[model samples]
Target: MKVLAAMSGGVDSAVAAARAVAAGHDVTGIHLALSRNPKSYRTGARGCCTIEDSNDARRAADVIGIPFYVWDLSDAFHEEVVEDFMAEYAAGRTPNPCLRCNEKIKFAAVLDRGMALGFDAVATGHYAQLRTGDDGMIEMHRALDHAKDQSYVLGVLTQEQLAHSLFPLGDTTKDVVRREAADRGLLVADKPDSHDICFIADGDNAGWLREKLGDRNPNTGGDIVDSATGEVLGHHEGTVGFTIGQRRGLRLGVPAPDGKPRFVLDIEPVSGTVSVGPRAGLQIDRITGIRPRWCGTVPEVLDGPAVTVQLRAHGAEHRAVVAVRPAGASSEGAPMGVASDGSGSGSVEIELLEPAEGIAPGQAAVIYDGSRVVGSATISGTGRSHALAQTLQRVAT
Candidate 1:
């Protein structure tokens, strides 16, 4: 089989390509030049767009005895990933750019182009497994090393992509991948993995957005009201700057009467006010996910027993009961009275055993059943209504 391997100048991809070659597959390495200006990468940062990274990929390809090339996808990346990231934040939604990049650039654009150029499949350094089902359908499974699993970030992949996708390092731990690269005389063997978001090189996403979008005046400060009473207790620059369950940076001079620190209970971007309350106020029983997508065909209903739902990659999968919501009942805007079954519009509600915190709108909520990834959806909004108080009382008893 002819495979096109994505080498990011990282040890994981280096070992992955070597493993593919050892498996009797013809593999070639390609480093994506996602950034037009590679020199913009910081001195210490090992971002994907750096000249050093491209050189590392070429060297690794040479060590593995494979043809190597650099493909520039900067235009598509800027359009689909970077621009969308800034726009989502400007619209008061925290977007996951990594997930978007996987969906648009890695899977859609790169995979299509590679296949057109006569490559049978596209391989990557992702720590997720792909298996073929009895009916010839490709199924995506969790990586063997749960701590280093990257299935959540690749949740947006389509079933067709999974059929031709290769993840050689899925079953191997990070340490093992690094050791394999070292054994093969690869230079990035002991290099630390890059953890920052690739495009934002630095972690200043908000600052990057501000530079892209015109400098909108910092809106006047407003009261950080209590979620229960609408009573103004403190002032804040704007609610948009805050997320749902943020604990610190609430500049409220007075401590919560109970001695515990105040947590951001809610952020009302419309009123430009944030609501501060005790930590208990952030707990929620249920969450709604929108724009749902699954590797397999959508189920008629997701009700069987308790399943696992992941709000973010590298986070615990919470045990939850899944239900298909009527297409447009919850806010975040959809046509009302639409399909109640999961087949039509693909909206869902994963009712957790307890409330999960740090869940923000526009993030993905991926569901899993055992080791297999079931599906995922965007968090259109949250359900922090008056009913939460009654739910909390029930939990307390």
Candidate 2:
């Protein structure tokens, strides 16, 4: 089989490309130059898309005796990943840039180009596995190392993308991958993993938005208020800096009546308000999500037993009961059921284990049935007792 490996010049990608070569497949290596100026971004020994990374990828291709090339994807990446990231933040939602890259740029653009170039499959360094089910549906599963599992981030992949995607490192641990690279004489055997987003070199997301969006709208000052009393606690620099469940970074000097630190409960961008409350106030039992996409497989619409739902990458996997809800009438009404008058949109209800904290609207909540990924959806809203009441009413009706 002919494969085009998306080499990011990282250890995992280099090793993946090498493994593909050793597996008797005809392989070609390509490094995506996502940044406009690759040299301007911090390459260090840890970052990807740096000049050093491109060179490392080229060298690895040489060692593996495969043809290597660099595809400049800066325009598409900036438009799709970077621009969409800023827009999400502007809308008061924390966007996952890596997930956007996987969905729009990597799987959509890069994979399309690979297919156009006559490649059989597009491979990557993602720590997730893909397999075909008895029903001919492609399924994604968690990596062998739970600590390094990245299936949550790749949940945005569509059915067609998974059909031609390859994750060679899925079955192997990081230690084993490094050992294999060393034995194969690859120079990137021990390269440090890229920690932060590749494009944002300094990790200052707010600063990046200010530079891109200008000081017109999203940066407008907002009042950080106490959720319990609706009293203005303090003024925040911007609402974009806060999320649904952040306990730290609130600079409000006012202490609680019991003298406890405050946690951010919600950020209302339109009202220019940031709501704060005690830690106990942060617990939420019910969550609703939108724009759901299964992991290359469509799920049964019937509500069944509880499944493991992942709220964030590297976060705790909690048991949750899920039921598919029908569309509601008004937008303000719960997106779950038919409006009291009977007219509107549908949504999914997630009953969480112990109230999950920091439940943001834009982030994804992926469901996993053991190693097999069930599906995922964009977290739309979270409710405490009220959200649970709505969930019950919607499903019962």
Model 1 TM-score (2 dp): 0.88
TM-score for each candidate, following the candidate numbering = 0.88, 0.89
What's the CA RMSD of model 1 in angstroms? 4.5
List lDDT for all candidates, in order: 0.77, 0.79
Q: What is the per-residue lDDT of model 1 for residues 311-338, given as tens digits with 9 covering 90 to 100?
A: 8767877888777655554576554543
CA lDDT, candidate 1, residue 377: 80
Q: Which ten residues in a row have the lowest lDDT in candidate 1?
A: 335-344
Which candidate gets the maximum lDDT versus the true structure? 2
Model 2 stretches astray by more than 4 angstroms: 301-306, 325-346, 386-397
